[model samples]
Target: MADSTGTQARDTRLYFPHLQTLDETVRFHAERQPQTAAVRCEGRSLSYAQLHQESNRIAHALRAAGLKPGARVAYLGKESEHYYEILFGCAKSETVLVPINWRLTAPEVSHILQDSGSELLFLEESFAPVLEQLGSAAPRTVVRLGATEAEPDSFPAWKATQPDTDPAVRVTPDTPLAQLYTSGTTGLPKGVVLAHRSCFAIRDALAGENLDWIDWREGDVALIGIPGFHVGGLWWATQNFNAGVTVVSMPAFAAGEAVRLIRELGITTACVVPAMLRLLLGEPGVTPEDFTTLRKIVYGGSPISESLLEESLAMFGCEFAQIYGLTETGNTAVCLPPADHVPGGPRMKAAGHPYPGIGAKVIDDKGQELPIGEVGEVCLRTPARMVEYWGLPDKTAETLVDGWIHTGDAGYIDADGYVFISDRIKDAIIVAGENVYPAEIENVLERHPGVAEAVIVGRPDERWGETVHAFVVAAPGDRPSPRDLHRFLAQRIASFKLPAKYEFIDHVPRNPSGKILRRELRDRFWGDSERKVN
Candidate 1:
């Protein structure tokens, strides 16, 4: 594909030809390093050989349970070795894995399950209440993740009866492997359908480049600080697994636990958000000595504050690279290499240059490509881009136009190709790496009995990058307390999506045509800030 500059991007497949499909990763690595630990989580570990065998069993069990090729298998749980087993099993069975964010409310989870048309669901016992709340929306075949010996519907018990032989299912690089749901602008979540090839495209492009930026090495033990439900975490884990490195999974991210894991396991590389970095730095008794083994720390999700970046650089004393992209772009297509990470370098604030085979351009509203340093909507063309937004042809066409993923981010590329993000065009708030769309929250807020109209905007936050703030207009003679509104929103949405602050307004500002002036409202909170996003 040619970039906006009319230059053709190199084909990634030609650079590295191995591991064309997700299933091929484990099989190839198992043959080469069968005894090496593929993943470790909560005192449990799985070797390459063991993971391959377990996934095979899961594949056979899925088939025996009447799941057909191309079926959607939903997983509602935290990060774990069993989660990856289900992931690869879905790959081997030609079924798509839909990993639900465990943080989502029952209503939100139900929407994904029903929308994906999943026939089976693998859930953690802790989320039993959520599944029960799903009721009719829940899939018919539900299997518990860690079940006892007496439980016949447990994942371990169910797969144990199946043979641990490869299902030998036919799959192509374009086959849909995972469906991750991202918050939509229309008060719902849209499933982003990613294919097997998405996992290998970026890695293939960088294979023999010998670039130290985000490179993998022998005996490298990586910390999966992010959860598997997010594309960043999933992509990072798969990249390490493909390179035959051991990945230590954190079932849930905790600053104290992460520090312990890094020091105890001699973790060499990690990928995390800036919020996590702050938490680690603030953790009690944390010091520079605890991160001696860390060679590189890759961070993204939101741009890092200069002060925070400098502090993290000093604490870790390791190579730091910033990644920029979305789930639609298969995690990361642009990388700010360590070379440009100077404390106050000119490019320090920039997002970064696109990967070898990836193309990025900023375009005006008229669809014309903007010149260097001209602020506009950023677009990316990469082999790692999602196949489509699942079952939404109209949205797919709108987002994936002419082979370029229209990233709803307002940014520009400098003469040196360093992308600088200035604002978000879609009015989406990212709280601690989690995307929270205003429309989704506003829809819920306005549902409250006292709220006549509501608007949600992001306020720059020191730790979370951004926090949800609500501007609510109450009904006539109805006085709504912040506490009451918080309680109402808490039960309906994820905790992260709840508004951190609420202000009662007489009226919500709107344009002549009735469109809410979101930017006008947001500008009040971001006054004089260099960038609109924190």
Candidate 2:
């Protein structure tokens, strides 16, 4: 183990150097630390050996159910040991796991199921009504996640009948391990198909660098503060597991519960969004003592305000690293190390340097690389980039050029190679770490009878990075109340995507080409902030 000063130990060793796939990480740990706790969630724990055996059974059950290699298996539930069991099972069988955000509305959920062509779905019992609403759109095979072992269609009972022996299905590092859906500019969600290599690529790169921006040590207990559906949460969990460390899963992020868990579980490390850090700090009765065991905290998903960062730094009293990346880039390619996390440091405004093997550059509209200190689209070239955006070849071609993933973020790098994010090139709003695209919400709002035209813009908020704000042009002789519009949109879109504030306007400003001048409307709320994004 490395010492407290981040220096490498003389006896340093790679945990599973020979492992080529994600599932093999489980086997490697189980063989060495069978009795060690792999995961603890909801008052239940799974040892490494138990997790390996149960995942093997889950793999056998998938094959028994006639799911061929590369079949999409959907999981619509919160974080749990069962989720990882199914995730590894899919990896072992060479199947793709599609994790649906349970917060999405039925129609949104139905679209993902249809787009992925998932044959089997494992959902929590609480979300059964969502599946019911889908009816014919739902998969043919649906299994309840939490049920007694004696229950007929419960996940435990279903896997119990299957043999626990390893199926030993051939899988490679390039095999599609997960298909995570991210909202697109086209008013629909696009599936980001990630391969097994994403989980290990950055880790392997950091091994030779000896930098401890984010390191995992034995006895380290990591908190999965974000939902597992997002790439941030999935990647964080895999990193800890790959290091053979115990992970504590939160079914859903509750600030009060997170505070309690940190103290009770003696969590040593955590990866959370900025919004979660705010909530954890504001949780009633929370004190610095609650975070005594925390050695490091990794935060990203949205730009954190300076005030929050300073407050968090003083409170948590741990090393904080800020990560920056998109789902298309396999989560994090750039990390703001703890050394640069000074209160008023010049690099505090920057998003930090890239990993050892990662490449980041700013490009002009013509795809020409820009000189340092010039703001443009930030592009990243990493081994962890997604294989493709599912089946959309044209979209894949547009984003992934050469070996670089063109992140739709406008940012510049300094002479010292520090990345400083300015604003978003893509007109997507991030609310509490959840991606909300204006096109998707505008599509739903325009369908309302009283709404003639609708435009969505992000309004910076202190709590959530940004809140959805809508500008509407009422139909002739028709005026709709915010309450009425909220009700209409609530049923059609996810709650997080709903507009928090609305304005009645005569016309929406647009250019001659009829493209919505979203910046004009968004600028009214931003005023003169240094960074357009919160």
Candidate 3:
């Protein structure tokens, strides 16, 4: 399909054939498309030249603040144009950017900062309370995005002191660019180190397939509602910025605000989780008219319910694509393209095909490849796969084997090469596209004084693809109210990780090896559902 500019959107390879690195992409646009809009948020916009200059200043500022190459710097804020500046700046300075989830509690935030060994921190003013709660535990050098008198060190003021000249630091495509944290089976978060190559590996792999749904075109206005902390949010913004398209960033997603932004900005394309789509549809004033300019809506992070997909296909009247990957896989290694989005069709149940350069295989318990239609561990080999789990060589060795990532997901590849995900080999629940590990929640619940045992599981929810459900055993004669547990967990973890539903049980089921029978607990909630996951 030709884009608004009458350019063949499918001919992307002809346009962006040599964007090898993030800094190179920025420089390419600044030199050739200086006047084009690069990013926009909350009514503010930055052109390519302006973005390049500001990031140059940020790179200098970070360097002056004692950050050297390979140093980690953390940012705790919602989506914004400033965040992209920091991202690019980090690339220019050869520093690694670590974005922490704003939804996490003070302790949770502190843990990531400490774990990453980040010396500098950038945050939004709204998170001052979390910093205050952290006290001396917070990072020593903090710069507030929109600082007030009370908050101090404003990001604008800091950038003004630095030179607006490029650092021109030497960095390779393999240089680590970002560290994204994901919950491990042990309940602690592990930092996934992404390299410059990780960001563009998938794009390079898709050079031949000029899928109009993903191709960038002049005059394309993209709406970004996802948080910048997750790969989905960070990569979406970078992808658009790299293409020199205008990106409208939503600080945080709200059903009403998202609808308003889509209408007001005339967003031509958007990438969202199924829950975001449902929320937009549920908004009272939203209609087909609101999304008229929206040409494509890409979703992933969790399987979309058939009902929601059908309703969305009818309501939005836009092309749909489903991306499948993990933070450790850069972003997308497999995609269910628009052509396969037929409702109720057999392909609808599949996760779509792997990208051209991605290799996917299902393996049995003995580590042998499984035949078609037999479910087993899903393994993926792609250039986009992460270099390693930061500072954990042992864990990295286990995950990355012979250049192939052993994705802890169970699925089967059909005769047509379509991949169908049956369940998670790892006990991770995806709530609105965010991965929530059961062990993380169980650790929090079992800590409560009135709780003797706890097991967390996922249950189907219409809005969020799946919400956390907890089955707990109270102490001898003590009853732990849901309200109390909620309050306790609120101070310990992110709100999204909290249980939406709770049940009191007399005993917690476990195998002889003392491993929690998550499948058994999940079965109680999932009933006879063929797929164990939502």
Candidate 4:
């Protein structure tokens, strides 16, 4: 097997030699750590060996159903033990696996299934109604896990009655192994295609590295609550699982349940958003006394304020690593190391330095490279990059060029190599010739006692062309008036940066991954028949 072309026709060897499919990645680890507990779901724990056998059973079931190689199968369900089986089973059969966020609306799921051409749908027993709305797309191959079947025409149950041989399957380096839909903030969801080589390259890339430098340990068990639909959740777990570490899964994140998991599992390494981290820390019994075993908390998604960060540092008494990357660029484009967690850090809104083998830089609107300390679009070149957008070749060519993924995020590197994310390229509000990054304004607003969470979007104004309006979620028992909220933020930032209008709400609409739905906020204002809201 040669890893080159323009030579004699031999076995095709991929760039990453370690793994070619999810099945291989899981099996290699399972064989090595057969006795290690791989999953703990609702009162059930499956060892690596048990997970292997169960996944094999799922593979056998798929084969029996006449699902061939390269078929797209989506797991439209929440995270659990069965989710892993469906993912690995499809991988073993050389099928593309798509995990949909259970929190999404029916239309969102329908779009994903139709866009991905998913032939099989593996759903949680509870989510059967979700699929019920999207009628016979892909023949409606429903996968019910451990529940009574729905009536006529519903799909088959994922039973483990039969045994399946761990068959040797082939996956080319370029073969698409999975499809994940993006946030669809700009428009419709883009199917981000990831190949076997790309996926394994990342897993293999970090395998030999010593996370010990970051205080990671084999003895550490992580409490993971991020939805598996997102790349962060799925791949972060993959990294730990392969490292022979245990991960306690939360089907869906709840502050109370996560606190319980941390207490019960002695969780040490957890990858969570700041919101979840805050929620966990704010809970009744989350003192340093309660978290005796916790060691490292890695967070990203969005920025955390200095106050929250410091409070969390004191509360957890562990290393906090902030990772920055997008679904398009794979993982760890930039990592804010624990050393940056100083008393007065400059990596304030920064995402941090690029990971090994990942090249990053800031570029101006004209596509020319910018000097350090200049705010521009952040871009990266990495082996872990996505091959292409599933069906948008034009958009693919625009975003990915000369092997660099032009991260739509607007930020720049400092003189010291730290990357600060200012705002989204499309999200930066241009008001009366002044550029206002929502993140900066939102950051200040979120620190206010009354503001629980904040999102900033530009609304059209006849005079300024656009003005900043805030959609804020107030803290419990606090509802400051729009005027008061504006006054609260006026001293923190410039007058123009102050949100002109405020809409108080119970909770800000956010994605399952905890990213504020800024697009939705914009749509609320932009979708109305009238324009230029005063």
Candidate 5:
């Protein structure tokens, strides 16, 4: 480990010489600690040796199946040991992995599959209907997971026949590893192309900074509750695995099951969004004892209420930290250290300071830097920054200016260097930690025959951080109730994206430019809530 002083560690690459690519790190650990447990999911465990061999097999199989380097392989399923195997296999063969959220509707799933140009798709049998609906839109090759298939085309049969020898493909740190799709401000989701360097750049910097809380130790056990599709889950699991630690992953976020797994696995550290913590607290059998083994808990991606934070602190009795970043930035660029997590510290509400080697600035509309304490767009420049939005040069150019990523979040830096997120400049609704765009839902709602027009906004909810609320303009001589619209949209979008409440208005609020006045609708619902975001 590096000393608290950052200089020596930075020069030495934090004693990790294999920082050239993720594949290098995996090989490094496989050689040194082959028998050590690398990952665990459900009742199965994979040692470092097993992980390396499985990934190698998968890579060879992918090559045999005619998947060339730089080809995109997508996965549509929940978290599992197979996730890491395929992810590392992609890195080994220089293929990009695209993990789609299983909650998406068929059209949404199809859009991502087609947009990413996925050559091969790995998914659970439960989601086979989604592909059946796609027909021509589906990927060329589909591998079914979960159950054993005896046919020659089955995932198990194919991987079992492949060679266990490493592919030994040449790749640089800049090689693309994954394409994570964040909901687009427009209707379609935009793929954020993340390179192999993203997994290590920030982590290596932190290692040099001697930030022990964020660092993984020899016997550390990490619990990943977040889905693998998002940067949070994949990044967290990779960080721990890179450190040669064990990662216990849950299939999906179920409050009761999460608590049980944490207790059963003796998870020392965890990464979760605030909503998960709140939900975990509500589970019937969850008690303080269940979290006794946890040493640290990192929460972010949405605003955490002080009341809930305090409740969690009292119940868990563990170190708490906050991470702030986006899918485009790999993961955390700004992190609130555990020291500033005091009960009523001024910095508690802040997003914390930027990590070492990370540059953050608040800029005005003209791209001019704003003064400290003045709200503006939060911009970040870091080595861990994404390569681009996959295949969207214009959108990539729009977000990445020079070397900085324009975070489209309204925030300001304090004199103490903490970033305070005030509002979102983009029209996005974060419902229970899931990014929901109004345009996407509006597009679905407007397609209904009885809906002449629609505008979607977020409203505060006690259970979910925020819930989608819709204001609809019914078609002449035909009116649709909220229940009717809900049923209509049931097959079109994720259930979570469905509006929690609806207001039938004659005319939807629009500016002279004919754009929906989302702020006006948001203000009507938010009222005097100090935090514009729920």
Candidate 6:
């Protein structure tokens, strides 16, 4: 372990090199909790022992499908027990697993599948339609979500009747675990290659730490109520499981259904996004008792309002820990401790000090460290940093400089070393607690026939913290209503990311460099405002 002073421990002979492979973690749990509940989905539970055996069989099937050690296999499905099995199975077999977002469109999903160089795709029944036209998309084998066919074909399921044995391939710590595609503010989405050790280290850091916010007890089941495609949802699930905790999961976030599951399963811990948190909090007849049974609730995405936080603290009768993290760090590098949730808390506005074993510093453009209370860019150096941006060497270099992943958040560190997020350096908006890049919105808006050029910005919102606003230049002859614009955007992009306000602009301010002066449009709304949306 490194010293707390951020120096290498040369004098100590106990050199704990981080575990580099995902199989190592799976093996550790398989032996420790063979019969313990490892995963739960839609009322079905799989014990750790059973999970290991199933993954072994899946690994064998993957090899039978002619997959090489370093082959990429995208798991295209919803939240389910089989999801993790496929992920860990790929890890055990030294294969890269890419779990596609169920929310993405057919074309969007195709781009990720093509970029990852996936040779096989394991999709659920619901997503079967999207894979219908993937002939030239790069996968030789397409595995269905259900039972296996007697004869292997282009699309088959080999997991049902396969035998369990040791995976033939061995992977090192640096082995790539996934190629998750996230939208870049500059242009198209890029694949972020995160290694097994990177994410596992994140979970490992949270280990044994007291979760005062949530009342986590032995044998108490938690809910994996989010999609598996995002880093947070997936890693948090593994985090609880690494410690032998039970987890009940759903396909996606839904209010009434999620409440039912929590109550019915007697779930103790739940990881939620701000939007869903609000939805659940707004559920009628929901009182302190409704969520009180839950020991703790962890929420992030957007900064929670004071009112929401207060209600959660009182209603849950436990701590409400708010986390601040990025996918570039493979899920989390910082978490607001439970103790910091109460009144007169230290670093109340800032996400609590960096998690144990992780170091964060605020630096200026020149990379010089800034003083506490000074706003600067937040940079992170930790075991959980992603390996690189796949197929984008230049972009990767610009992002990860000198072992520090540049988190493009404009924030400050307090005297107590607590980090406070002020604004995102990139023109990205957090709507309903989900990161929605302006570039993505612009791309979709520009596709409209009556739109010439579109620029998207964030507007201060009381309910959502920040809502997307679009300024567009009309084409030949047009007068688009706000409702028409919203409906058009709703058809192209996710409903939550559509522009809430539309402005007709004759010209967009651009500097000599031809870069759109987004700051100008942003200033129009937030100039007289007191604070930037966190």
What does each candidate score in C-alpha RMSD? 4.6, 2.3, 2.6, 11.8, 2.7, 5.1
Best candidate according to TM-score: 2
Ranking by TM-score: 2, 1, 5, 3, 6, 4
Better-scoring candidate (lDDT), 1 or 5: 1
Better of 2 and 4 by TM-score: 2
User: Best candidate per lDDT, number?
Assistant: 2
Full-model lDDT, candidate 1? 0.89
Residue 199, model 4, lDDT:
57
User: Candidate 4 lDDT, tens digit per residue, 181-263?
Assistant: 77433436688887766555554444335233233354668777677777778767765654556768888788888777777
Tens digit per residue, CA lDDT, model 1, 376-473 = 99999999899989889999999999999998999999998888999988988999999999999989888888999999999999989999999999
lDDT of 3 by residue, 1-534 (tens): 545433346643223656767898888789877988888888888999998999999999988888889999899988788899999999999999999998998988878888899888998988889988877667779999987544349988888878877777788889999999988888989999999887677766665565443666668898887788888887877777667788888888998988888888889889888888888889996779888998888788788888888899999998998888888888888898888888888888888799886899999988899999999998888888898898899999988888878889999999988899989898789999889998888988899999999989899887888999999899987897999999999889999999998899889888999877878888877898888878
Ten-residue region with minimum lDDT total, candidate 4: 5-14
Candidate achieving higher lDDT, 4 or 6: 6
lDDT of 5: 0.86
The TM-scores of all predictions, comma-separated, are 0.96, 0.97, 0.96, 0.76, 0.96, 0.89
lDDT rank order: 2, 1, 5, 3, 6, 4
Regions more than 4 Å wrong, model 2: 1-15
* Tens digit of per-residue lDDT, candidate 5, span 408-466: 89989998788999888997889888999999999989999999999988988877789
- Candidate 6: regions farther than 4 A off: 1-21, 133-135, 146-157, 203-217, 344-346, 479-492, 512-514, 527-530
Q: Name the weakest run of 10 consecutive residues (lDDT summed) in model 2.
A: 5-14
Q: Give the Å error, residue 450, model 3.
A: 1.2
